[model samples]
Target: MAAADVIFLVISIIAVGAAALAVTRKNPIYSALFMMVTLLVVAAVFQMLSSPFLAVMQVLLYAGAIMVLFTFVIMLLSLRPEEMGETAPLPQRIFAAVVALGVFALLAFPAIEPGVPAAAASLAPPAAEAVRFPPAAGTGDGATVEFGATAYFGHTIFGRFVLPFELVSILVLAAVVAVMVLAKRDLSKRDVADDGSDRDPPPLSVSAAHAGSIASLATSTQPTSHGPGA
Candidate 1:
């Protein structure tokens, strides 16, 4: 195998192993750390693929920002050890494994085929020679505006994929709102009943009940002095 292929193989193994550990670990903090490792390894793989922008995004957006958020949320929740136990049924685990294996097969099969390079080239962006830029307006001498990968990426995202981009933003906002709603303790439900009144008073304590009975008996047994009129 070529050196690049060997390097890719090593990185892929590390990324997958770390990702698996991230999900399966019992401790949330440890899981987050493992996830960071996975993200960093994936970023390295992106760099190897000659996509510096993607590598930077993987590090900054996922490893740095998102992981920090995850760690903060995990710490804020203060999860107990018992709460972290694996609760998924055996059948669910088996099904998950099967699904994962199927996905792996689907992805790997195309990549290993001899026609993979041609397929990938067909899907890739147009070559530099094929890119046509409109003539610069000011000068009669026709000059095409030269732009880099970042400009192309921005154009593609804002121009062609704007709807999907906006939808993703809305989805993220909804997720944030949902998390806030879930985290903030709802005292309204706890302090009031569904009928919009205070909850029923707790049953009287044993001591209070016993004291009331004793007082009643004492009142009944008390001897009353005869009044002057009587």
Candidate 2:
């Protein structure tokens, strides 16, 4: 095998291992760190594949930006160790492992075998050609439109799959709006009473209320001194 192939294999193994660790880690912060490692290794694999644009995007979007967001959200939530749920039962985990191994074996058999070419030829004609879009107006008739990485991505996303892409954006927007709505306090219900005469007090933090109660008790229990004549 070529040196490039060996490097790609190593990177792929590291990426897979990091992904598994990310999923299995008990701590959210550690999991996020592992996920960053996975993303970085995947970006390296993209570079090995001669896709510099994809590698840059993988690093910037996944490793840098998305991982930062994920870490921020995880820290903001402040989940306690006790709040984390228990792992799945051993039997259930074993069953899942078996299913995953079966799928991997099914996929690997065709990939590792030497009959892939024969299978591909049987599936489609060897002379089958790719569909190419027309060249730009300034370009000659015989010249085909040559698309770089960014241009090809833009064309695929905005040209043919524009509707789905737009719908995905709308879905993301809706999710954000929903989360904001859920996080907001329900002031409308608290502001009005049954007869619309009394308004409920805003909810106070437990520690603050406890401290206020303690202060009031201390003030009430204080002994008063009187003059001798009194």
Top candidate by lDDT: 1
Query: Residue by residue across 140-228, what tens digits does model 2's lDDT show?
Result: 43243233355445555677779999999787666655554554477366455578576644322322223333333222221221111
- Computed on alpha carbons, the lDDT of every model, listed in order, comes to 0.64, 0.62
Give per-residue CA lDDT, model 1, range 50-164, as digits (tens): 7667788889988887677666555544544444444567898799799999999989988789798798889865665325533435753234322334444455567667999
Where model 2 places Cα greater than 4 Å from the true spot, the runs are 95-148, 187-230
Worst 10 residues of 1 by lDDT: 221-230
True lDDT of residue 178, candidate 1: 58
C-alpha RMSD for every candidate: 21.1, 16.0
Top TM-score prediction, candidate number: 1
Clashing pairs in 1: none
